[model samples]
Target: MSTTTTDIALAPGTWAIDPTHTEVGFVTRHLMVSKVRGSFREVSGTVEVAEDITKSVVDVTAQIASVDTGNADRDTHLKSGDFFDAEQFPTMTFRSTAFDGETLTGDLTIKDVTKSVTFDVDFGGVGQDPWGNTKAGFEATATVNRKDWGLTWNAAVEGGGVLVSDKISLTIDVQLAKQA
Candidate 1:
């Protein structure tokens, strides 16, 4: 069954993303074989929960320089011109256009290129933190062509396939606290 905003008891108001608990991660195939995962450590966003849950809106921004994949070299390269070109475009943003409890459709902009993408939304429910703060959790995922956002750098592998796959899978785990 589809969930409604009321069904979750998420109060109507502006919910600010808790950066410390939120993660914006991506996974892509390497050499068309192994998968490489990376995530942005700095992300800020807000969710405007409307009385009608379907009308809720989400807006987020991630700092390109905060990308971390465990390897320092690879992380540096990702910030270079060959990839995200962090200097030219220091941030990526997402603005929601529609939300239906199960899916969220939005405009994602990277490197000045904007594309509409849809993510399957999984609500992780709401609860109170030790500080008596009201918080909600959610996980959303989507796959998109990296080239669409101008992230097309790649090299050919020794045996065959390219170094990086065109398709990039995005997974976002977010925790939001309702603002008083």
Candidate 2:
């Protein structure tokens, strides 16, 4: 059982994440036919490691209003109570609680609802960018019921189907720097 990183280290140097190079995104079933994917533009997070990145930790948070799907009406609808209700809950947060090799358990909060979620986190290890900054990368993905947090709005189909599925898959590609 990985414990809280109370005394986390900063590897041995200072580095920072390239927000333009990171992605915080999600995927959900749309009309039970195709899937929709979107990402946030304004996201901030941090990562800490000791010597090497293998014993590192990460925490991240994102702004809800920054969600965009390339459509104005659809984005408005998503901001309503049917989905994110961005007006009320302006932010979504994820704080890593434990890191066990390939699995990471953390608290995920959205729309005022909080849940303990585990993600299959695969580390890409640390490397140097072309500009010469030390960076560590990781990708995490998980599926959870959207209705579990009261995002239950849906419409019944004429022949008997629902507008949206309950399961939503979230994928995150985090690029962390040691922080200067």
Candidate 3:
């Protein structure tokens, strides 16, 4: 649905992300031929909407050690020094710097490296749940260079290119419960 200033205005105030219904995921090309996808099991965030919708903000964090690609061995490798080094950098975070109805620009920090990124957000509308809780939903997506975040570890494939692609696609589907 197209989100208007009016739609956002209706969602003003602080909302807590419902991790049980939210997903923080990523995808990247593997061996330059196939794609690999994964999601973090643990994520926490907050969305604050100001009277002026453009001033809204979002802050989120994901535990690196909770990344799951389905394969145990791959998950271990992802948490090792070769990639996220979960022992040293246990978390990755994002804090929004700007929001203008359709676009949300933010600072993303991974492995202690922070970079500015933009995501296209789709507001799924605001409503009340069966429990009578005020809620809002949003789906956001962005593409970023993994190398920029110090996730540069890779192996050369015999055919060509590397084992992992530099570009990582991120998708976040969040359901937020408005706080009193």
User: Mind giving the per-residue lDDT tens digits that candidate 2 earns over 1-180?
Assistant: 232233223365434555777888878777788888888777887765446434555667788888877777977888898888899998888877777666777889988888989998766667777987777776888998987788889998777778788888888887776565
Please identify model 3 stretches exceeding 4 Å from their true place: none
How well does each candidate superpose onto the true structure, as a TM-score? 0.96, 0.85, 0.96
For 38-84, candidate 1 gives per-residue lDDT tens digits of 99999999999988888889999999999999999999999999999
Q: Rate the local accuracy (lDDT) of all candidates.
A: 0.94, 0.75, 0.92
Question: How many pairs of residues collide in model 3?
Answer: 0
Provide backbone clash counts, one per model: 0, 1, 0
Candidate 3's residue-wise lDDT over 41-123, tens digit each?
A: 99998988888989988999999999999999999999999999999999999999998888899999999999999999888
lDDT at residue 33 of model 3 (Cα atoms): 95
TM-score order of candidates, top first: 1, 3, 2
lDDT ranking from best candidate downward? 1, 3, 2
Q: lDDT of model 2 at residue 161?
A: 74
Candidate 2 — number of clashing residue pairs?
1
Residue pairs with colliding backbones in model 3 are: none
